[model samples]
Target: MSMTVNPASVVDEGEFTVRRTIRIDAPLEKVWAAVTQPELISRWFGITRFTGASGAARVGALGTITWPEREPVPVRVEAVDAPHRVSYRWCNPCLGEPVPTEIDEAHSTVFTFTLEPVTDGTQLTVVETGFETTSDPAADLESHRGGWDGELDKLVALLESGS
Candidate 1:
């Protein structure tokens, strides 16, 4: 039995944010690991690598997420709440431009993954905000809206496939 997945939506109530909520047919612990663990995250999302004492996800952890044929985007863990929530601030560089060596506070957005246990599976909601500070707010919002759609779909597939 496959679950219905939802596309991401933009919530612009004076703040530019992209949000998506999906129900994955997997346990909460499995979902949490996919989002918090660097190795697991790299499997579903971009290739993630932390640049500090450890590569684990925790508050203030610095990292980069690289996609094929694209520059590595700098990332910083902003918050972590065990198997519940984890948020990261990442650089959102303009198209064809290289991302900063480190996360640029002035040109970055924060994305949060919030997970909840459900009767048959786990419900995950990703909220990415701070697009108002980007080069093009509308474009970035739409881009990320589509981005979350693809990225989260991979995550659902990875976990639900029993891998």
Candidate 2:
């Protein structure tokens, strides 16, 4: 079944945040696993690996997401609500610089995935905040706006492909 792909929008009400809501032709459980599990996430987004405390996504779990031709970026699980919601904080501004050993809250952003059940499938929404902390707020916001658009579209295609 074909699904509608939604583009991400930037909300700049004092603080900068990127939000996107998309409907996927998949179950909530499946969507949740894709967003929460490192193996599944790596398939569509980046090569994700969680470290510290079982290498699973939970509050305070540490991890890194490596993309092609880019350094491994440090990430931390800030919150998780089972198959419903999960938020991660990462050092996005430090991309070109040496990969930080830890997340610098002062210069990081948090991206949260929220999943909900729909009549035919699941509705997944991602909201990335804290861009004000980055070195260049406008650049970071615009970059992430495009980033989510591409990334989430891949996610929708992955889940809807029934692979």
- Cα lDDT of candidate 2 equals 0.85
Global lDDT of each model? 0.86, 0.85
Q: Which candidate is the best by lDDT?
A: 1
Q: Which ranges of candidate 1 are over 4 A from the true structure? A: 1-3, 11-13, 53-55
Report the lDDT tens digits of candidate 2 across residue range 61-108. Answer: 888999998888899999999989999999965346566767997889
Residue 91, model 1: lDDT of 93
Candidate 1's residue-wise lDDT over 35-154, tens digit each? Answer: 988899999999998876354598888888999988888899999998999999999676776678887888889999999999889999999999998888888888888888899989
Score residue 8 of candidate 2 by CA lDDT: 60
- Name every residue pair that clashes in candidate 2: none
Model 2 residue 41 lDDT score: 91
Model 1 per-residue lDDT at 70: 87
For every candidate in turn, the CA RMSD to the true structure comes to 1.6, 1.8
